[model samples]
Structure formats: C-alpha cells, structure tokens
Target: MKAGRFEQAQRQHIATLVRLGEGREALAGREIIQRSWRRCVDDYRLDPSRPRPVRVLTHEALVDSREPVDELLYVARAGVDQLFAQVAPMGYVLLLTDRHGVTVDFRGHPDQDAALRRAGLYLGADWDERHAGTCAVGTCIHEARALTCHQREHFDATHIALTCTAAPIHDPQGRPIAVLDISALQSPRGLESQSFGLPLVTLYARMIEDAYFLHRYRDTTILRFDTTRAFVHFNGRGLLAFDPQGRVLAANGEGRALIDAHAQRTPPAPTQVTQLFEAELDDLLALPRCEPDQLRALRLRASGEIRFAALVEPRGVRSRQRDAAATDAVTDIATGATTASHDPVATTSTPDLDRLAGDDPAMQRLLGLARRLCRQPLNVLIRGETGTGKEVLARALHASGDRAEGPFIAVNCAAIPESLIESELFGYLPGAFTGGNPKGMRGLIPQADGGTLFLDEIGDMPLTLQSRLLRVLAEQEVMPLGAERPVKVALRVVTATHRDLAALIAEGRFREDLYYRLNGAELVLPPLRERADRRYLIQRLFAALAAEQDGAVQLRADALHALLDAPWPGNVRQLKSALAFALATREGETVTVHDLPESCRAGLVSAPPLASTSATSEAARVRRESDDALADPEGLALARTLAQASWNVSQVARQLGISRPTLYRRMRRHGLIPPNRREALRG
Candidate 1:
C-alpha cells in the first residue's frame, strides 16, 4: 500500500511484460490494456520506477482552453450532472476532460473532494495517455472507446491503486471532443463489482454525443440506422449525416462501422453514397420501402460484395396547410386531382423555409432560383422522381408568380383514364357523347383561366391528348370537344413528370414539341432521400399530424429511429402513411416502436434463445451471458422488458435466450427495483 512498495511492484510487472516480449499475448488483462502496456513500454519508454507528477493546468490556461468549446461545454453540463449523479452514490469522482485529456470539469462528494483532487481527478488535471500512461481518461481518447483501467492495469506506479472507467464523446465528425470518466482512489479488487461503470459511462457519453450532433447538424439530413432496430438509440455508431449531394458529411463510431462493412474497407473514406453502393443514390431513392427481411442487398462497389442495412431519413418539410386553395395536395393523386391554393399560399413559411434551408448550400441555391423563376411567366417544367413533391413545388411557383391571384388547378395525367383524358382537358359541349351531361362541364384548362395549370405526371398523358394540350399552350385558347369555335383563355402553364421525356419522345410515346414547350424554365426537385432538410420535414409532418388529432403525439427516440431508417420509396406519401399509422396506434403521448407499422418492426434486433444444454455447459453459458448483461443497467431496462412480457421471466428469458441462469440471476439481482408479485411471494 505504501508508495515505495507500489513502485517496486510496477517495476517487477514492467520487467515481466518486457521478458514476455512479443509473446505478451499471454498477459493477464484485456486486449486494450495489453495494447496500452505495449505502447507504454515500446513507444513511450516510460520508466516504471519513476512516477511522473500529475500535470494540472493553471486556472487562466484552463479557462482559455475551454473558450472555443463554449457551446459544447454548455451542452455537456446536463450530461455531466447526470453522470455524476449516477456514479456519486458508488463513491466515484467524475472527471470530464477535453480531447487532450485535460480535465475541464470535475464532480465529487464534498467529503471526498480533497482526496479526489489529490488523486488528480480535479478540474484542469491532465491525464492524456502519454502523460498518465495506461489510465482510463488517456487511454479512452487513444482508443476512442469505452474502457476500464482496473487497478494495476495502469502503466504508472502512482496510479496503480486507482480504478478509472471512461468513455469518449465524439463530435459530429467522429473526432473525440471530450472524455467522461469515473475514478476512485481505491476500489474492489475484482472487476466484476464495477461492471456497470463502463456501460453507464458509455450510455451518458452517447446521450451527450447525440445531443451535440443533433444541435450541430439540426438542419442537415441525419441518417440513423442499425442492422436491427434494437438498441439503436443507445448505440451512437449508427448515426450519420449527409449533404444534399449524397456526400457523407459526418458519422458516429457505429455509423463508421456500418459504412466500413458495406464498403468492404477498414475505415471508409469520405465518399459519395454512389461510390459505396452499386445502386445510384437516385435509384435507391426510387425503390419502394424495403422491409427489414427483404432489405435490398447493398452491393459494395469495390469488392462486389452484398450487405443489407436499414436506412432512415430524418429530414423533410412540414406538412403543407390544406386550405381550399391548397386542397388535394400530392396525397390525393389516387383520385387524379392534386389541387393548389388561390391565396399567396405558404408551403412552409419563409422563416420555416429559412430554418429548414439553414446552411444547406444546395437548398439555398434552389430556393434562390425558384424565387427568380416564379416572377416570370415561363412554361416551367419541374422534373423529379415520383412523390418528390413536384406538385408542391409547382404550387410554390404559382404562389410566387405574377398569376398569384388566379386559380391553381393540378391534374395528374397518369391518374386519368384514356377514355376521359381528352374531355378532361378540353370540356365537351352538351350532347357531345351518348352519355354526355345535359349541360357541358368546364374542362381543367378553362378552369385555370387567369391562373396556373399544374400538369402532374405530364409524361403519362395520352399521345393524342398531348397534341391537344400543346395546341392550347401554343394558341392560348381552349376548344370544347363539341364547340364551334376556340375560346381564348389566359393562364400560365407548369408541367411536372418523373419520366425522361426525351426517352419517351424517342419511343414515340411523348411529343418533342410538347417537351420543348413545357421546358421553357426547368427546375428539378431532389427526392426526399437526397435532401439535407429531411429532419425538419419529418418533425413538421409529425407536428401537423398530431394537431389533426387535437392531441400531442411525438415519436420516442427509438420510434423516430424507426421512421428515419425507413426507405421511403413513395417519398412524402409513404412517410405520411407511417406517421398516420403511428398516430392511430399510439396509446399515449409518445409513439414508441410498438406503434410503428409491421414493416418497421420486421427484423428487430433481439438476442436468440439460449440453447438447451447439459448442466455443466449451462454455467459457462451463464458466465458468457453475464458479460453482456451488465453492459446496461439492470433496473430500468430489465423492468421495461419484464413489463413487455407481462412479468414472464421464462418467456423473456427465451426471447433473449442468451443463457437461462443469466436472465434469472439478473432478475433476482435487481428484484427490489421491480419486485414481481410472484417472486416476492417466493421470497
């Protein structure tokens, strides 16, 4: 216990490690510790006998060093308090340090504050791996993972008695920004007692990372997913942010792993979405929402290997206001008419648009071009994939154009039957057909007189109807099917389609002259997957849908992850269905994963049932299960899972059947937290 004795023990240990040399694989420690020990000996050449003095920065330097991360400091304050609160009862001192391992913040019980300070667990203490050898704060930053440096596993003699558990907090771009560490001057000899330390610390660390990333890239497209839906919110590695062009802008640790696996590389480089998968981003964006069981195999472009992953889109515009003017928006395509407003309709308010646009350079440019083009009377052709909001963009253009006061009528060419296509555009006079109405009805073209006509899916229009539509556009007049003369009608023409009109022309399916007539001023709408503003759109839709029910409904963290991971082939239309399903199924205020559709629940991440085995083998299974059981605190997680199974441990155990005894033991261990009625009776 004395300093002299500790020094002697460290020297003997170092000499033992040196004698083992390359055979250090036989050492008694975790791989992380063994690796750190090798680095101490071979790289740093730290003297085991000479204990280095703990370095604490001066007050002025510490304050200055933290200035650049003022926002981060503010964001982490709550997490710091929460982590400290969780570990304080266990007699642990919490030290939060910057990337370089200089303690920027510290929390400890009043009675033990002095002892912690003397142990260099106070603010400003520098515990970087090089300076403090193999300790938690320093080694965690070096490894970029959650770890525990048990007593004697530390490389320095003076630190041999202290046990430290730490987890790294990375910035949006996956660089370590800070480290959350819990340490004690002395602790139990066995590591098992402190098993909850790393998990608890890592959980809080990820909570902080998620908060920081959401705040940092709040306006960008943040894609969060996992191989299975289980534990995604707790797993920071599956979160990623991308720009409008499908370039990966940022990723957390797990996200990097998913990217690497799919890319067939160690750590994938900053690459476009296209380079990583054989499917072009646009093509993938076009496919229907694939269920977890049937997830399209994402082919690695480089190795030609196939992998499956669930993707979530966390960006989009808020649901548009559905007044009479904007009635029948895109979702009404089943009936054929996707209408628009006569008022200077706001798709999303200017402020909301600005907030949604944020710093996205691509969106800013798009918005700028749209604003300018709206002022002109050009026959605007909006090109985009189906469900990419061509109608919405068309409405926005009409609202901003000189014809803002005129009516805006949207017609889905694809939704109209061929028999009615001609009469639908050019109204027929009385008795034009055997079943004709006693009085002729005004066609959609004349209905748009003195306003705008939005032709949605214009490519799907019949070839004969295209010629009639072109004549109306070229002559600025509409001729009723049975009328004796043409009636002049003034209106702006806006056409949108997902099809490549040029290809249609070559196939003799569409007219080239109609294409040229509609292509006066062109704007292409990016699919929801490609937009960086996806997050805003999602939240906005949820907010609007919740309002429709006159109740507050929101996606819980996991439910949001489920929504985000869905590949919305129908784009906004598909997302609306999922949100509507959640609203209908959700029990209370929060929409958890259970409320999500069956497609979202498919392939949920769950541990397999424990195998039936001999009594002797069962014990080893229990031991192995114990390794992961303590990775999360037993009280809350255990209680929730128990409640889900209606307190059937046998069922729960079978469901998470890693080991039989492990589940029972854990339930018994945390019995008081959620004391089962039957278990209490047995007790």
Candidate 2:
C-alpha cells in the first residue's frame, strides 16, 4: 500500500476501536468482534495506537512447538487440503493453528511465501490474542466460536488491510483444541465480502473435528444419528460414544449442543442412552442385528422427534449364537485343558475352538492346543499352504479368545506396497510425507488397540519394519515415523504364512528374534487330501452350502464319490468353491456327478464307458419312448437321456443323431440345462 493510504487506514482502525470501547455497541460489526476488541484494550491493556510486529518463532522453537500438535496435523490434513483447493483460487490462504494459537500447518500460494511470512500467516507464527491483538484465530480462541475479522475489525493498525475468518475445532469434551482460519492480505472494504468465509470455515472445522474424533475413539462403540433416516448412514449430524452397558462416555460438539438444547431440564441431562432416546440399552444394541442392512429408528425422549440412527459395534456387544459357543469354550478353559495332546480325541467340543475340524485326530489335537492358547492372550504362528484356510483359522482363534469382542484387523503384508506398509502397519509421524495413500497415517497398527492384529503372509514383510514389529511386541508400544515418543497399545498378535520362516532365517531373509517373538506357539494345518475325516468334512460343507441356496439340493451318492476321488489341491477354499458351483449348476434338485465344475477335477471331464447291454437297452428304451411323433410328454425323458450320457452334450447329441446346437436349443426350450456346460462346444 502507498504510505499515505496506509497511514489513513491505521487512523480509521484506531477510531473504530475507540468508538466501540466507549459505546459498548454491537453496531460496528458482530457482537463477537465487539467483545474481542473490548477485551483487547481493557483486559489485555493494549494500546490501539501501537502496532505490534507479527511474532514468528525461531526454527528450533518452531520444531518444539509442532510436536504436541502432530497428531491433529496428521488427521486434519485431508480436510485442510480439500478446503484449501476450494478457497486458494479466491486469493485466500488457509491456516490451521494449535490450541495455543501458533500456526502448525499451512497452505498458500508458493509465489507469495515471502509476503505471507512477513504478514505472520506462515507456519510457526503466533496469533494469540495477547500477542497479535484481536485477529481471527486469536479472537476465535478467546470467544470459543467462529467470527469474521474483516479490515478495521482487527485491533492492530498493521492488520487493518487484511481479512481473516476462523472457527474453533473442539474435542469430544467440547474444549477448543485448535482453530481453522482463512485469510487474505486484501479484501473488499465491506464485511459482506467475507460472507462465504465463516460458514465454510465452520463446516470444515466440524468435519475435521469429527474425523479426528472418530480416529481417536475408533475402538469404542459410536452411535451416529440424523433427523432424517435417509442421511443417517452417510451424513449423520450427531455422534455419541457409549460403553457396552449404555452409559454415555463422550459426545462430539453437535451431540453435546443438541442434548443440552433439547433434553429435559431436570434428570441431570442424560448420563445413559435410555435418558436421551426412549429405548432400553438392550433394545438399542439389538438394532444393529435387527436391521443389519438398514438404519434403525429412534425417538427422542425430550421432543419425541424421530431420528434415523446407526450404531457402530466396535466389539461383540450384541448377543449371537456364537456367544453360546464362546461361553462353552470359556467354561472348558476354566475347568481343564481340552486335550492339547495327540492321544486324546476325546476332548470336549467347544463352539469357540472345536468347530473347524470334523473328527480328524491331528486337527482335533491342534484345536485343543488352540483352545488352550486362546484362553489367554498369546502370540501364535499358523503354518499352512496357500488356500489352506489360514485366515479362517486365525479368525476362529480370535473368536475363541476373551478378546473376541474386540476388533480383528487382518493385514496381508504382501498386498500393501513396501513404501506404504510401514505407515499402514505402524503409523507415521504427524505431517510425515506419504506417497501412495495420502491418508496413510490413519494406520492399521494403532487401530488394533484392545484387539487382535493378524499379520497374514508375514514372510513378505520388509526387513526394516520387522524390527519395529518386534519392538512393538516386546514393549507393547510403537514409535511412529519421526516421532520422538512412543504410543502404548495392547493387542494380541497372530502371524500366518505358507512360507517356512526357518528356511528364510537360514537364508537371512527373516529375523530370528522376530520369528521367536511371533511363535509363542505354532500350529500346523493338514492339507485336504491328507485328512482322515475328508468324507465327513465334505458332507458338512455341502450341507452348509445347501442351506445358503434358494432351494435345498440333494447330494447324490455318485456326486459324493466323485468329490472323494478328486485331488483337492486348493484345500478347503477350493473345496467350498467347488461345492458352491455345484449348487448353482445342478439341473434338478439334486447335485449329480456332472454338476460339479470341470476345473475341480485334475483333467478334462470325460464320459465313462457304456455300462453294458442293460444300460444300452435302457438308453434305447428312453429314446424309443420319445419318438418324433410324441416328444417326451414331460421333458423328464429328455433329462433322462442327458443324465445317462454323463450330461455330456456331444455324447448325448450323437445318440440322438442331432447337432449339439440343436440339442442345446431343445434343452433350453424344455428348461433342462446340462449343468451349465454349453453342449455346442462338445461338437
């Protein structure tokens, strides 16, 4: 600005402060600013005539000041970047300040860095009300609300040329923890020029606050609701955290404001869920299972307003049939060991620990060991080949334990990129650079608090991170990247891999110490072909698959025999997929030998040799019955012909003296499918 114009603006700012101080009026601007200006002169004993230079901390002091706000910076970056993208084009710079009013995170035009620094809008700048006088962040911190400090509203003469709007970011307890501000070095003279600024700042501030709230309390039960049912799941405006027994623990700003304004004047304003909503704790918990795919309806006790609500069950708070099984397992553990030895096939069967196997002696013994191991928090190493259901076993182990109610986060070490795995597994320092996923610091390791961390394919994890994993296991704490301090976490670790770690260690590819740390107890899973109880397992699996189908399908004797003869190289996963395919393709209500997928067998599907004169006579009898004059009255005759030929379209088409396409067309006309195989390809 020109010297003469700058002097004139400073004189105008001082005159406005003097008029507001003497009149004690709300007319100058907003009541919030009027209050801040009064406090600046009377409470802080600051002279409006004197202009204070912007206070920017030295490099070392800036680093020290940033440490405590690191986590907030990490969680708020996404929302900040998103809002900055929208407003940066409008000549505004976004600043996120710590609760103490020091700028910790910043985004602005790189070309104008020097001007922003000189104006004290850069990182490490302090904007405390006592230091920077009445400014957006400083005044917002003191008022604990949102306001626009445009031009002459600023108490400092040096700042009369700038316009800044800011909102307070409060924690779950309603304490202002940070401030979000957007400022421009120059703006239009009227306050209406900043009409868009305060509202957008307030909206994103709430978003950032809610995101950090969820991140901080991710392991706990959170109840979110909205006045409209349609928006409950996607944009619930209220967030409340409660214990398993329905006792209110903490609430976000929206929740607190709603409760305080609408709840009953008496009865201490709801210390329990039943107080706020007219429903018992059990009824509320049941809502999740009652409408697992839909938002539940809740009525407020104060206003009877219907709320569409969603409950996030962080643990197994709701009762399930699995709970009955878990109770049995816990009881067994209390009494005695459930046969963790090879000779005892006579151990007690538990719903928690005994359901994975079906009469295999080796598996029975291993499950017995698993039952004993799960009774306490112990690290376990599961060794099995690919597709051998290692993850399922890991889940079963987690379910059987006391920690079953807690989270079970499964991480496939091989799937995540090496650059990202470190941050994802162990978290990273606040403001740390992450290339792959911008929000990588919302890491998996910290989320496993009070739960299980299942590391699948552990053999593929990078060597450098292995040491950090070992340290976390040993000390029960993890140090994030560039972090000066460690965070405490309680978790049960389970590692599984098909690769032999012993061999890897011999080749120096795996850590010996980490191996021992992971292997407090080791369990091996037998391949499907090697299990003595294969027949029983197959029957059990087929029955379960049948239950899931629209119509129950019968497993014919020949189908069972064929399944028994096949080499199940893919183990249980493959077996289940094959059975499911059979159910999907079965022609009638029965699963026949030919209904199974061709890929399930080692070689291509081929028809067996013709039985004898008896079978031939029967085929001829069926064909004779279906003469061209009277086309098999019921389509059953056509179905019979197809079945006799092992459902092979080529073989059946030859017997009928028709091309495969014609046969397929006739079959489609009769609604008699040949187990999904296109007979035309056989020709």
Candidate 3:
C-alpha cells in the first residue's frame, strides 16, 4: 500500500531477474527457488513487479475450503494452538492451508490482525503458486516437502518483507492434504535466522500428519518403531499399519523412508512387514502382551540393525479374529459352520450390538459391553474425541437398557452458563429466586426419573456444581433449591467429554470423587478417522442420503477416492455432511472430482502417475545411477575402507555404520566385486 515500498520492490524484482539471467553460478545453490521462479514467470505468466492485492475468499467460500479438512483441523488443533503460543510472542503468525494453498485456519495477536490480514497471512487467503507466486506454502505444495521461503525467495516483491517456513501434511497414501506454515512480516536478516523456526514448522507438520495417520488406522494393527527403543512408544517416528497376516496396509512418510533405507533398489513400496523387518505375524500379535514400556526388538531384514517397535493391537475386541483358515475338522465349511480346535468363531461373522454399531472393531467391542450391561443398574462414562458421537452412544445404551421405557434426558454441561447451570440442572422451587417460575420446575435429573440422564461435556461443568451432581448420582436423590424434602430418582447417568478428566482433577478444576461416581463403566468411541469401518460407513451414509433425496446421485471413482482420503475430523457427522454437499451440488447424474466441495478436494493430487514401465528397465536405470554414484567421494571412501578391511563384509559393514545386508546390496548394486573375488576374501 505504500508507494516507497512498491518502488523498492520493483527495483529488487528487476535486479533479481537480471541477476538470474546473468547465469550466476551461485544461483545453483537456490535451484529449488530458481526453478519455482521460472515456473511462475513462464508457466503461470506471473509478473513479479506488477504485484497483486492479496486474494481473500468470501466467508462462505472459506468454509467450503475448510469443510473437507475439518477432521484434520480437529486433529491439528492442539498442535496449532501450542505452536502459535510459542511464536505469537515474537510477532510471528501461524497459517494452516489446504492442499490447494488456501489458508483455512490462522492465529495471530489481535493487535496485528488487520496487518496480518492485509499481508495474506490470515484465513481464506490463496497462496497457490499460480495465485500468489513463489511462497512457502505454495512451493511446499509443489515440492511435497518442507522448506523455508525466506523474504527474498518470495516471487512477488510485495511478499519480500515476509519470511515463511512451511511443510506439507500428507495422508497415509502419500497424498498431501494440508500445509503447516509459520511466518513473520519482519524477521532478522539472513537465512540463518530461520534455523530455529524451520525445524519447528516441519516437526509439527509431521506430528499432525502422523497423528492423523494414527487416527485413521486406530482400529487396525499398527507397528510403530524408532531407531532407539526408549522413545518408540512416546512419539515414534515410524508407523506401519498392517493386517492380521502381517501385510502392510499403509505407512507414514518416515516409515516409508525407513523401509526404503534397507532396499537396494526402489521400484514398488514394500507390501509386507517382513520385507523390511525380520518379524512374523505371531511375534507382532503377541507384542501387546508385553509391558507397555517393554518394546520388542525388531531387526532390519537387510542389515540386521535393531529397531525398537511397539504394537498397537485393535482396541476392545474380546475374542479377536486374527485370520480365517479352513481345517480338516471343518470340512465343507461352506455348509453351516464347525469350530476349529485352535481357533473359534472362524466361520461365524462378528456379532453386532445394534444398528448404531457399525463394523468398527472398537465400536463393536464397546457397544457389546454396553449391550450386556444395559439392564444392570450402573452409571456409565463415555470418553472420545470431539465429533465421535458420544451422545449417540449414550442414547443407544439407554434405548437398549431396562430404562428404555423411562424418559431419557440428554444435557450438555458446557452449553449452559455457570450462573444458570445450578438452577437448570437441580431445578428451583417457586420464589427460590426473584425470576423463578411460579409453578416450580423439575431439574434434568428428576426429569430422567426411572430412565437415563446423558450428561455431555461433563468436563466443563463448574467445580461447585460437580459436587451436587455427584451426590445425585451416588444417592439417587435430588434436593431442590428451596424444598423442605429431597426427591428420590432412579436414573442411570452417562457422562462424556473430549477433555481428560484426570488432567482436570490434577489442575483442581474438576472434583475427583465425582469422576469415579459417574465412571461406573467406561466406554470410548473412536473418532471417524480411527474407525476401521470407514468404507462401510461412507457407503451406508451415501445410500441414506440418496434415499433422502429419492434420486440417484452416482459417485465416480475419482470423487469417491477423494472422500475416502479426507481427514474426516468431525467423524460420522462430518462425513455425512460432506457427502450431502457433494450430492447436492453435483451436475447430471454422476459426481466427479470437480463436483466435490473444495475442502473435500484438498486430498486429491493434481496429476498422479498412472502406470509404470517394466521392472527390467527400472533395474537397469538404478544400476546406471549407482554406477555414476561410485565416482563420488562417499564411494571412494567406501572403496578404501573395503580394501583396508580385506573386503570382509561384516568388517566393512561395521565400519560404514550399516548392516552387512545393506553393504552387500550396495556392493552388488555398484557391481563392485565379482563372486570369485568375494569367495577368495571369505577364504
């Protein structure tokens, strides 16, 4: 907006272009930036000197962009808040953008909101390479990695005053869904100033991505590991989601990289857990029986290097069905069913509690317990992440229980004001207060007499009110504000919250006794991302949506894949809303990728590799590449070490800090030694 700044920017842009055209060798060091600059000018046809105003989307459009990643936002909320808290003091702002490079969420000091908004660091601003030219978020989107686009690296001179660091958050399938960035309008000069911030941005980005991965695969068998055993359970860098037979379904970015490290060549990703580690399915399944702190030692298949791994078994399955196999005892198993001696429930399908319990293993287990305990006179506490349908679970429990005929009153302790919560929950006698109802009103507890009382967000209730609620739950009696006698009520209380009640108790914000009183039986509902039955639920919800419209809105494969890849932070509720939105806006009969809302499209890769050539060509190409690498300094040192060690594989492996298998693979790749020479060395 300032004339002087614009003039300065134009000069810098012109000078930078001239310097780039001069074929300066130093430009090689900034190849990534220079390549992006060329793409901006040649491909996108962007003019750096003619700086454009920040493109901000309308509120509705912003919400549409935010919709698909609502689940990712939920998973990332804690990370974003904590990151902002650390950077806000230094005048830095945080921006989380969808894969399209539009900022969906942001945090900055209130005092600087206006300035930040104008700088395009606020929500709804498009930072796509084509829209805003070279920037951290946009470049990160293109590169599919993390980097710092310092002030001068920004294409538009208008953005030269801002230095931003950003990293991409990829889904489990390696498709990017979002970008996490931290930027400052003004920072200390020189690139070294970013040393502290780049790692922080990239770290949180990976953390959020890994958290989302875990959330999506929570109900399956997950094998997590790290180089060292100590930190494997507490935020391990490698995550591999496998099936009961030890086949890898998916892996996080770090996990994939770790697997690739053991391979001599890269063609297809690893398909089995055994390809990377020498561990069997039985070993993996039995890891859950070990102490939580005691991690199992997993050795790399190639080098035999040790990696500490922890197994996350499927939650809440009583008689878990690992695999299906036909035995002689159960001949002609197709005709009826016969139980095997080694494995039971081999022929029968898993039991379902009710319609509300989808095929998710965790949900099935929890609901099974709830179904069995419904007739019992016991209070229940449900714990789950936000948007996990805790209230729905409580309602299901009530409907299936002996109290189904009685009234079921659901209350959100967080929705009511602290001042009114007392009267609203406990009721008040006439004239108890100046504004009291003349006829006297019964509280929520009394209204649920001979039934169920569902208290949602119970963690937010005021500390003072927790005591009274606890008393009601313990005594099955309620005392009105101004009544002479207490009222007796037979109601089962169920409470749920996204917060950690134990943490709250330590903070002295929640009553300890009240937690136990309501926690007669604990049930946790997994978030949608973590649910094993997402595919089933998605189809069921879409079919229901179609029935609601009473028309066929066909979903194409592209559009459906987009839906499946979504972060789904809001769980079942969010998925239904997205399907509905796509169905309503789609043209003709079929829904294509373009028909989905912007948020839903965040996980869709622009143009993916459709096919690959023969393995022979790939192997040849890798051989050639390795042949060239042998001329490098690293190769020369390795060769010298091999000669010094008399070509002993183990000795060379130990000296090179690699496993013998890896060393052999590398040697074979480079065509280093012949079989005769290797045999002579062994002799």
- Please name the candidate that would achieve the greatest lDDT relative to the true structure: 2
Going through the candidates in the order shown, the clash numbers are 16, 0, 2
- Candidate 2 lDDT, 1-683, residue by residue in tens: 67799899798778777776676445543678777777888899888878887898888887677666555666686799899999999999999998889997789999999888878889889999996998999999998889988887788888888899999998877788999999998886688978999899999999999887775665568888878776666567888888888887888886896678565554467788778888888888766522334878898888778887887665222223334335455444323211122211111222334447767888876775676577467799999987676876887888767687777777888888898788777777656773544443645777777878889899999999899899999999987776788889999999899998999999999999999999999999988878877787677667555644443568898788877877777677667656755565457789886666544444432444334576454433322222221222335456656765658889989998999999977866554545443333222
What is the alpha-carbon lDDT for the whole of candidate 1? 0.68
For residues 112-204, could you state the per-residue lDDT of candidate 1 as single tens digits? 777777778788899988868889988998888889988877877777778999999889877879888999888856777779898899888
Candidate with the greatest TM-score versus the true structure: 3
Ranking by TM-score: 3, 2, 1
For each candidate, the alpha-carbon lDDT, in order, equals 0.68, 0.74, 0.73
Candidate 1 regions off by >4 Å?
1-31, 38-45, 230-237, 265-270, 274-683
Query: Which ranges in model 3 have alpha carbons more than 4 Å from their true place?
Result: 1-6, 18-28, 265-269, 289-292, 317-683
State every prediction's TM-score relative to the real structure: 0.41, 0.48, 0.52
RMSD of 2: 20.9
Residue 189 lDDT, candidate 1, scale 0-100: 69
Question: Mind sharing the TM-score for model 1?
Answer: 0.41
RMSD to truth, every model = 29.6, 20.9, 27.4
Candidate 3 on 1-683: residue-level lDDT in tens?
36697577668775775455454423458777888888787788786657886799999899789777765776687788899999888878999999999998888878888878888988899999997988999999998888899887888877877889999999887789999999998775887888888889988998998988876786688888889867788788989899877788888997878767765554355688877888777777777532367888888877778888887665323212221121221233212111111211122121223545567778766765676467668889999987676766776677666677777677778777889888878788988888889888788778778888888899999988988888887787999889889999988988899999999999999998999888988998888877877776666556555544444667789877877777776566556555654554344577676544444554432334223555444433433343343334344345445645656779878887999889978766544452244234323
